[model samples]
Target: MQHGIHPAYRPVVFRDRVGGLTFLTRSTATADRTVEWADGTTRPVVDVEVSSASHPFYTGNARVLDTAGRVERYHRRYGRGDGAGH
Candidate 1:
């Protein structure tokens, strides 16, 4: 609990342009841009590339990795190493 040593934590807007979503939250992060929130107050707006709205994992659009195929391709490109340690 020190005075004048902590960054100001205030209501900020995190915008996800790709998903066209905006949310207001409290954070220490600030931005030069501003946006009018649903409450009719203008808060510092920060543009984020990935959010739950646009993230594949969160949206249930994530692609399943084919590890077996990758291993086969790798073995094809470079012969599988011998049992002997190299």
Candidate 2:
């Protein structure tokens, strides 16, 4: 609400580097790259590592931990041998 003391607000693109996924979004972030969108307009493009498209939780490819095996191995190595549960 002041004078010309604020940064430029424009349209920018955030591209996921891992998944090669890109989306159009407005932000104050600057980009050294540009791309043509579906509207035939050139916009700033930014590269990202990972997004929901490639993330395990979002893609439903969640990885499971081998906790049971680790627990059994630990008990056999350092846990009590009386089988009384430590």
Candidate 3:
């Protein structure tokens, strides 16, 4: 609640390069780059490598890891022995 102690919050554009998506929001982050938004105004633009649009989890393209196979491989290599304080 103190004045002049907080970063300036303003409208900024987050651009996802991989997904080719852009979103306008308010944040304290700033960028030297600027881009024209859909509202016919120029705003500070920040380029991101990945966002919800391109992320595997958000896009439903995530690959399930084969943990069972990994466990089998580990047992085969180390031998499945009863943990009798060994």
Candidate 4:
């Protein structure tokens, strides 16, 4: 790796506002805001909208789409395009 060309990799805090979760991890991402972690150290903080805590799949709040029903409805409204009726 180059000495000065690569971005600084350091410990950063990721905050999920929706889930009210915060964690410390190493990342190349940076932020102007800083936060004091549990270890009594200040680190750059990044705000995120979605995380494992708030994501539907991770939290088991995902909705199963009715794809088959949609296809059936499309066939009824627009036909199957088999060219038999036309």
Q: What TM-score does candidate 1 get on C-alpha atoms?
A: 0.76
lDDT of 4 by residue, 1-86 (tens): 86999999999999999999899999999899999999899899999999998999999999999999999999999999898884
lDDT of 2 by residue, 1-86 (tens): 88798777888988888777789888889888799988999999888888987888988899989999988998889875778766
Per residue, candidate 3 scores C-alpha lDDT tens digits across 1-86 of 89999999999999999999899999999899999888899999999999999999999999999999999999888878678634
- Cα lDDT tens digits, model 1, 24-65, are 899999799998888888899999999989999999999999
lDDT of 1 at 59: 90
- Candidate 2 vs candidate 3, TM-score winner: 3
**Where does candidate 2 stray beyond 4 Å?**
81-86
TM-score of 4: 0.82
Task: Kindly report the root-mean-square deviation of model 1 from the true structure over all alpha carbons.
Answer: 3.0
Top TM-score model:
3
Give residue 16's lDDT in candidate 1 (0 to 100): 96
TM of each candidate vs. truth:
0.76, 0.77, 0.84, 0.82
lDDT of 2 at 69: 93
User: Each model's C-alpha lDDT?
Assistant: 0.91, 0.86, 0.94, 0.95
RMSD of 2: 3.0
Best by lDDT: 4
